[model samples]
Target: MSKSLNTLFAALLLSSAGNVLAASSVDLTVKGLITPSACEPTLSNGGVVDIGKISAKDLNADQETHLPSQYLQLGVTCDAATLMALEATDNREGSNFADDMAHFGLGLTNDSEKLGGMELRIVDPIADGVSPWIIGLQNGSSTWIRSYYFARDNILSVANTGGAIPIPVQQFTSSLRINPIIAPTSGLTLNNEVAIDGSVTLTVIYL
Candidate 1:
């Protein structure tokens, strides 16, 4: 082969080798755990209740269940400072006397920001033979109930700047009160014998 042709061939081979080396690549990997198992609510009763069994009459007594005073206090812990709003719901599948009220209070760490606000909701199943009721609040003042219906749903929204925020890396406590009402016709006793096995799902949106 000619000298020029040989030089050209050598150059082409070098370029091809460089291209091969440049084409080399590495495998990339990413992983995480989403929606790890949620912790179940610890029932007032000793037995652990499944989420599905929350509204069954078999679990509850014939009488009404009064809201626990302790429920008026709830607390949440997180890695960073956050603003929280909450809503409460009942799974009263098809009872005639399923009614409830939820009260809430927010507490934050010393250096934390002020509370933006919160909302609460109560619901009654249509299959139940009673009417529904609603109560709400905003900026720390309670609002009047607008509607009442049997076996319907109710909602309340509350907001307050009066509450303080906690310091960074510190834990804070909040509280809520839930009261259930029963219809007179259901023959349900208001003796507070009722049992409640429900979960309160709280969604905290950081502002």
Candidate 2:
């Protein structure tokens, strides 16, 4: 199941089966856990990747244009050694050219045309001064796999080389490489300057 930092509130109704017709009330219970240790995640350069001005005539007319890849450092620090995970949420959703989870939207043009897409990859993760294997649990899967690419609404964690579960760590750092692709210019509205607007939020989750 997918994990989240939000407190889970579940209400359990209790009633006697024999008194199904006579019972007038039932007991309700709500349960959740709150951890003491908190984690803070930060990105270098204020998490901004500024791709300078691009000329419309310089873009490909019939094919996608792959821009130069950019790298950003992501750091996560915890008050104590805590089991945690990172989740990425795209602020510009539904604007990508593809429907794949690995692709993040770059925003739209003319209010209807998709601008393009971008892919985020996590590389060389170091946890507590030790290099650990980056792991991610696939949606609907119970097992964790060795993967560094960020997926939509997926939790990314770190573990030992042979471990299957996330390990506790007070500090974690990694490089987030961004690969951006622009759609064909022939189909885009280039009459005015179209900024490449892509925003994603990285959240830390206590596991």
Candidate 3:
């Protein structure tokens, strides 16, 4: 073959190889922009109460009996969109031990423009010596009570009440509703923001 023809052929092969290499090579660039909104009305502090430690003697006997009430009101804050829900569990592994005894209701008020017509509810209350009382008051009225029973073989039986109410071999449940405004005379005005906080009082009459 002629040298000129060989040079032309070599140039064509080199160009084809370059094209194949270019096709095999991959180059990519990815870009993204994200913006997040700031959080509002940062969560304020609150409080909690453990019913197990509360003794029956601390009630009417002590002048400072109100201590439990104070502890109950510690960190309670309710919003119109997000209501509070409370749960009480009595898990005693002994042969004859009653569950916790307690009563609860809601207290509400709206004094800010950011919220109005507040409402609360009693989600659950595991009372002792009686059935489980799960009911909410319209405006913190008509306290719901329940008797605690002993757990035997993972089953709870209501304690005997001198022929008052029969003991059930299972757990009980109850519910209640809380309305911020019960009377027509009660109207809320939230100029900036509404805040609701209160304490729960539990009066236990031990057997």
Candidate 4:
């Protein structure tokens, strides 16, 4: 039986070699572009937004408490004029009380309840010392829109005045505003001191 099976396999191989075979092998390619220009992104105040200690009595019990907005200086410097975009990602995912992707989580309580959320907005963008409009592109989308809200996993770029296309820039600066909102205390267990543990990472993507 083994000999018969081997003979059948040999006959099939010979027939395959004689006929036009269907994809006996495929070509694999790894393609990418390496540019000479490099960009560095930086945030003032070490990218830390301190909400400070809050009194339990000062918190709202029935509705969400909106804290005062804070502003941070965001700057990006490139070795040469390059087209790039800034991407934001939530380091502490799935902890925000809100259901919106633009809201970043402030961590959870000891009882595992979502603490709160924070929103980031990019405003007053200046590219190469000229005021320019800021545009954002969401993941898996090709369209770019004029937006101020910096959503998670979104790409933000700068465009010239009256232009919708993103342009190459060497220096970019903007004011990043943070609006923090705390969930009502009625649903949270606050027997112990809870820290505001929200962290987000800003990355530079070369276009």
Best by TM-score: 4
TM-scores of the models, in the given order?
0.30, 0.84, 0.21, 0.86
lDDT of 1 by residue, 1-207 (tens): 699999999997987974555555699999754432232222233322222222334323445333222333334344443333223433322232322233222211122211111223233311112222222333343443332221113333222222222112213342333433322213433233233323344443232
In the range 1-207, model 4's lDDT, one tens digit per residue, is 999999999998887885785666789999999999999999999999898999878999999999899999999999999999998888879888986888999999899888999999987889998999888898898888887787875888988887768899999999999998899999999999998898989899998
Query: Residue 164 lDDT in model 4?
Result: 68
- In TM-score terms, candidate 3 sits at 0.21
Expressed as tens digits, the lDDT of each residue in 66-128 for candidate 3 is: 232221111222222121223322221111111113222222334321111212233333333
Q: Provide the overall lDDT of each model, using Cα atoms, as 2-decimal numbers.
A: 0.32, 0.88, 0.28, 0.90
Clashes per candidate, residues 3 or more apart or on different chains: 25, 0, 20, 0
List CA RMSD, all candidates.
Answer: 19.5, 7.0, 24.1, 6.1
Ordered from best to worst lDDT, the candidate numbers read 4, 2, 1, 3
* Candidate 2 lDDT tens digits, 1-207: 233322232212233434456446789999888999999999999999999998988889899999999999999999999999999899999988877899899999875788899999998889999999999987788889888989895789999987779999999998999999898987788888888999999999887
Model 4 clash pairs are: none
What is the clash count of model 3?
A: 20
